[model samples]
Target: MPILTGDQELEQRNRLPTLMEVLGRRTLAPVDLFSFYIYMRDQQRSVDYLDFWLDVSQHMSLCRHYVRELRRSMLVETPDMEKATSKRSSALLENFGESLGEAESHPSSNEKRSSEQRLSAFLRHQHKDSSGTNQSPAHSMTSQHSNMNFSRPSHEPKPSPHSEGPTRPSFMGSDQPQTDSNSPGHTVARQDIKASAEKILYTFILPGSEREIVLPQSMLNRIIHSIEEEGRDDPEVFDDAKDYVFQAMERDAFPGFLQAKALGNLVPLSVLIRLIIGLASLMAGFWGGFFMILRSIPRHTRCWLILPFTIGCYFLVSYQYKIDVVAAYLGFSEYTFMSWARIREPFVRKLLLTRAMMASLMFVAAAVALSVLFIFVPGADF
Candidate 1:
């Protein structure tokens, strides 16, 4: 493949809208349609990201099927269109004319021809349903409203029977090579493979504009070796290469530290505030209920104590779970590892963590006071 120059790239970009216009023209040939699909897929890869891989894959599959259908229909219909106008004096009239007699004389062949023609017509007009409701392609290329169906206008002048069907246009072939029927879309498939490979490389490289990572020399060497053996014939080598990448990424210690750092930095102020509010609410609810049960039940009827005890236990378990989750997210070893005495914090780490702890304790105290006022003080219904 020739390297695309800066001017060539710009020209390709500008030609996109026109190429789309050409594809939308009802005069598109099979080869033209196929080329359009290939270009569309390549363009899609450039715009689509890793998160949308599944959607892109599904769309690619649909495009392949649509192109296949277009090729089949063109093969059957274009030749039939040619034969239809053979007896006509004007070759230009041939493009639109149908040979009813030839279709009739073929016996079982008539049914087959008719069926093929009907299929072709359906493929041509499939964008519009019988009720004239416009439908998107099998996979959406854009917003449904943005995707327009291109159909030949009934009043458009057609070629005479003596004339040939429209010759395939030239502009479609600038960067695209001529496609042969037996090729089975090698270019687009190869493009997808390359896109996937690049994505894999990026996954290991780690994407961040702020800094370039210096991976371990051993790991880097392993990655290079893996790339070398990517498509080797030996199954063991391929598996080993895959394993090497997996192991490099999966190495627990380094990633664990990086994750610790990321978790520390990424935890938002709102999340810490929310955690404090939640814990405070829990403590208030639990303690208030505990004291209430204690006052209401008789000392003789000790079984009533279990209700408040159960409530306290439930609160404790739930709060512990919540704390563990938050602590993990905030880069603490565990909930119990909150204080510097238990677990050391980096120089500036306490700024956020300390605030979170203070807020939590205040909430806890407020909840306890509220519970005391409600349970012990008389006429405190509100």
Candidate 2:
């Protein structure tokens, strides 16, 4: 075995090895190579440093064996490193033509400790080179695993039985032998991907406030289904609902209860209350108009009064005040009323006022006419 001279070690410093070279020189299977890459990558070490280690190991042949043994030992002894079994460790040592006993007996405690310190320093140097700041190597390692992709290369064919080595565990503990889709890790990963893809964000603008709501794809699908179901029964309702949703999206405004109804969700209590109030108002107006007409009509002219009173009552009950009241009760603010008041053109205002006054006078004339008929046709019936 060749030994690395002092000058050689210095020359190879701060360089990392390529994945191919590491696999070739280390005689590692693809899976093992992947694990090694993950471990180093998590440590935030550069490819240059990896190359340096590989070069050092090649020159000092004993260095390669020792490093491999050390990694296996770390896996076995360091509880936090990875879940390593005695069988796996033995397999690794056997593959490297070394025994655990021999490895332990040969390297003194000082030498082992020194090697670990050197590796630690190498990692720290790599971290500083990349980030320009001192950061905890262990923390960096722990943080990166969640986001790392362990996808297998498409070009690399599966190993044949003769070429296959012992099944090695992933350093991240996620690579299990089972290809079953039911595996917990795989299921979680699938769910994560689905969740990330399904995330839908909608911005909602209300009076003096803004908010964002995130709906999963499943919820959106349900909403779509609801719309489709509703459409089958009532096309007009479906069209209105679709228009409402599009308008909401365009304006970034979702009025309470109305939006829920548009989405075919349950009508909110507030909306139900408004609907009830509107129905009651219509009923009350109808009854009030009927009684007003009845009181205005004279019993003597009762036969001729029905038609005029019916027409008059219809107009009276459909008055602008009923509309204004309903609008105000349903959250149309003073600002909305002010918008209507802003029509300040003299001609237009006068025309609108004239039209309103004429309607009112017509109603009063119908009542007065009835009274006059009662006076003229006295004793026709009270």
Candidate 3:
């Protein structure tokens, strides 16, 4: 391969259309094109990138121009597409008519043909003067062949007119009294139209990544129009657009954090800080409780030394087990404490609680034993 010169490199860099040109030409969906511009912008960290966006800001109003061009193009192409579809449908109907004509040699086939003709007339009546009506090709064909039934020849035995009771009305023919909106054929046709209209066709580049998002045209249009209207009063509409793009980009992060928290993979710094503060507060409260208990006894008594020593041992045991007195004092339930502790197993949690409670009891027993020993020992002075 040959090496590229400076001019050639510059040409390669400018090969892609500018944001203004892309917006004006209607080559890509407005949102996708803009998002791609943002992705490219985030990658290049230089004054040149700033200048590129500044150039884009000058043509922010070009979005309206592109919308107008799209409308015009649709107006031009819709007639051709409709004409083609109509021709195809008419051809299919002609083929069906020829097939029915071939079967006319049979007497039963003539009755079937007459019934089909009546059904076709009814469909034509329903569709007449309604240019915007869109029905599936299958539904249209089925409607054209509705209410068909074969009859026996006159030579065969027939049921007496008195034996036949009044018949229920048929929904498949024009002679039917009322239209059934909930009929299976109508429902299927409506569903087909809805599914086709909602099908996604456009893919947009997401900000801060090379990934693209696919969505229906209507949804994309609504999102783009909403962003445009929101930024209408702002002097820098491009900045507003950037804000919307980045907001969409960050939408997944929140759900991802929640999933991580559920899986016990996430530990927020704020939570850790809160826990540290709570632990310190609990230590201070324990010291205060010890002081209050000691004040109830004489300060000069030999039991005074035992209180401090026992309290120290209790603090050491509680700290080792990571138990906070404030949690129990605040009337926290087991589930609440489990969440704070981030422990999942009930057995391990119960074991830790047991150890903590035993430590407190041991401290109390030590204080009582020391006092009894002092009282019994001869000349055990304060």
Candidate 4:
């Protein structure tokens, strides 16, 4: 792959709006979407498909890296890399380790973070670097690898797709050939790759495994055979399964993710609609009820005005759903705005959810009270 200059990469990553735009740009990754699903899943843990899809993506990344390193090692003549590889493999396979797709590119967990802020910082730095005439390809790649999706410490070097040949697995960018394929490092990277693939199989692919992803029996057997019998760890081996999960997620989960992350901005519109409708009904009910009682119209005819009032109450109360809390606590102008999905902390999300729940309880209580007033004493016109 050709090295991307800073401008080319900036153009590549500037806000993908559509599914095709995201897929075509190779900028909006599955992790971005899956991470959103995981965020929303904290409210309801039923979103297993997104989590499963993420594992599939991670495994494919590992396999792709494995195959690349394997081919690179094939041309080299090196001494046994067994001892070095053993430690690396153990580390790589440790407890379904972090996703390898762009670990170097993500921010550390402890920071007060927002995905939008990170993306903005990433774009700003790129613009500044691209403005300079003397930028090198290695420097551009390091900037991308270290801080494209998220910011990193400035002192760290750049990283790139092909640059992390297992042994050099970080953004400490270097221009040297990935390995003296003839050097003893040959087997270490490939060995790590193999170990990771096996770990993924045991953790997420095999039947009755700890966290197995749902797949057809034949597909599972084929994958098991590929990893075990044939020892073929490459993107090609998992194409069917990857396509399977990709299609499932695209058809079902993507719609919901898109709705929550994109269309959620319409929440304020819903609130406005409810507020307008509620005010109209509330006015009509109060004016009509008073007008009837003053004119001494039959209680039967005027009591029906309570119906619209009750509906108004229900909508107005339900619409409150703690918008003030969202704005005050989360500093969002709207509850479900895309930036809201950027909140990485679970406790913060739970706090917002709790406040919203309290408002829902108020709506329910108001609904029940109105229902009782109408049912038990419809003729009691006050």
TM-score leader: 4
Task: List, residue by residue over 1-382, the lDDT tens digit for candidate 2.
Answer: 4555534533443233233333333212211233333323322222222322222222222223233434544445556434343344434434433333343343433553344334333333333343533222121222211221333444222332322231222222222211222322322222221111121111111112122223344544443453333211111212332334434332332222112211111112333444455455435544544454556644444454435443443344224222222222232211111222122222222333444455456556755664344334434234
Q: How many backbone clashes does candidate 1 have?
A: 16
lDDT ranking, high to low: 4, 3, 1, 2
- Model 3: which residue pairs collide? none
User: How does model 1 fare in lDDT?
Assistant: 0.33
Q: Of 2 and 3, which scores higher on lDDT?
A: 3
TM-score of each: 0.23, 0.18, 0.21, 0.41
Decoy 3 TM-score against native = 0.21
**Best candidate, lDDT-wise?**
4
Query: Per-residue CA lDDT of candidate 1, range 195-258, in tens?
Result: 3333334433333412223445665555445444442111121233333333443342223322
For residues 1-382, write the lDDT of model 4, one tens digit per residue.
5556534654554342443323322222122333343333432333444445444444444333333343233224223574254353323332112332233344233221232223223223333444523121121222111111112324332332322111112211221122212224332233333444565577568888765668999999999998888665444456677678767756755565544433222244456777888778777766766666566667567557768777777567645552433342452323232333233223333444555556656766765665444434433345
As a whole number from 0 to 100, the lDDT of residue 280 in candidate 1 is 62
Write candidate 3's Cα lDDT for 1-382 as tens digits.
5545534533454222333333222222111232223222222111122222322232222222222222333345446666565564444344434444444333234654453443333233323423435332332223221221212323212222322222111111121122123433332232222221121111122222222243345554554453333212111323433344444433533233222222221123323544555455445545544454444434345444555445554444444333443343332222212333233223323433454466557656655664455433434132
Distance from true position, residue 229, model 4, in Å? 2.6
Off by over 4 Å in 1: 1-199, 206-214, 218-245, 248-312, 319-382
Model 4 regions more than 4 Å off: 1-35, 39-47, 63-188, 265-382
